[model samples]
Target: MESFIILIKLLCAHLCSDFILQTNEINNGKRKSGSKGLLFQFIHSITHAGIAYLFVADWCCWLIPSVIFISHFIIDVIKCKCYKDSLSTFLADQFLHIAIIAILWFSLYGDEIKLSYFESFCSVKVWLTIMAYLLMLRPSSIFLNLFLNKWTPTSPNTQSLPNAGQWIGYIERILILTFVLVNSFEGVGFLLAAKSVFRFGELSKAKEIRTTEYVLIGTFASFTIAILTGIAITRLF
Candidate 1:
């Protein structure tokens, strides 16, 4: 349990520093190719190391901060210098950070990890759940988006808030996946009903058949893919 607790703390720190604490100026600076970017990266790495060390609450372990600082610095540098800003790159960056934390937990806790909650990570169900969530979160969204692109209407009435449809699809799939995993088929129905009342009602009332059909197609596709994925994952478990 200690391993799991510490790992969670470390991840919380990472999220706090990497996302919540990071500002637009710092983000833009990190993407630049100069000493200026290096300066920002240095500051960002320091924040990560400091936050992690604080979260771990082991003042005697300077090595924790030292390792975090060096590793984070290198990762950020490589990312900024070698990679473009894309979903894959972002996932890779976060994965490296989390991997570092897992390694750090192992290094500090050693074999004790096996006796504690770290063992859950080694379980097939745990990894399968992770894979399922990953699929529903982004991969499935991209697939649906690309496939639906050809059918997208160019009509002015088809316009909505920027990236609104994408976000809706993400939320809907995630909820559907959760509902399926929990064996709550009716929750999916409630979700679809709610969306129909709130969203489809607007589209249908707009008197734009093309736009309404486009939305319907996307919604049905999203639901089908998410439900299938959830069912597959449950069966695998």
Candidate 2:
């Protein structure tokens, strides 16, 4: 019972920091006004500090989820905005998603929580969750854009990215990959899969086959390079 209460409190704190606080500031135009209410906004922003601030003694607690959540939030935001054809608006949404996901993950799994991993290439649960989110993002975005297009003639033409979004998508994908790599090699395969999507999107943007395919191919060829590097570092340092 006590644990449940603590979880609720933490969750509420995150919610307040991520959504309510940001929305209030936006409505009041505080985000735009720099010097006018800088101190006030600063105080409010501290409601949820960065990943470092949350993961205190338990380093692993901070390592995995922070990278996962932040990376996921950023990718979703960028993709959402690209779909809407509004970069600025999508960035704003991304910022909000970062805050919200950060708060939620911190609240729900802040402690030294143990996650189940089988044979350990990647945990079944983690992979499933990732796939679920990926499916949700692509389909949901397509449906919403289609619905809007059908109802509103003014709506931007929907693009399915016979390839992908643009440079921004590639950047987001890389950041996500780096984050995952930092956490575990089990996710290296996932990163390779993500690269396929990135390349497809890039080809769409570049309008032809590009060196990205080579990069993805090279990525596969160099799979154990990180492990070798890690071993060397351990031996030398």
* Candidate-wise lDDT, in order: 0.80, 0.42
Best model number under TM-score: 1
List, residue by residue over 133-152, the lDDT tens digit for candidate 2: 33223323333333333333
- Model 1, 1-237: lDDT tens digits are 455556666766777678667777998999887899999999999999999899889889898889889999999999999987665787788889889988988888756654544446445455455556656655566567666777876664545787777688889999999999999999999999999889856886866677778888889999999999899978864
Instruction: Report clash pairs, candidate 1.
Output: none
Query: Residue 39 lDDT in model 1?
Result: 96
**Of the candidates shown, which would achieve the greatest lDDT relative to the real structure?**
1
Question: Once model 2 is optimally superposed onto the true structure by TM-score, how far is the C-alpha of residue 115 displaced, in angstroms?
Answer: 5.3
Q: Which pairs of residues collide in candidate 2?
A: 163-200, 163-201, 164-201
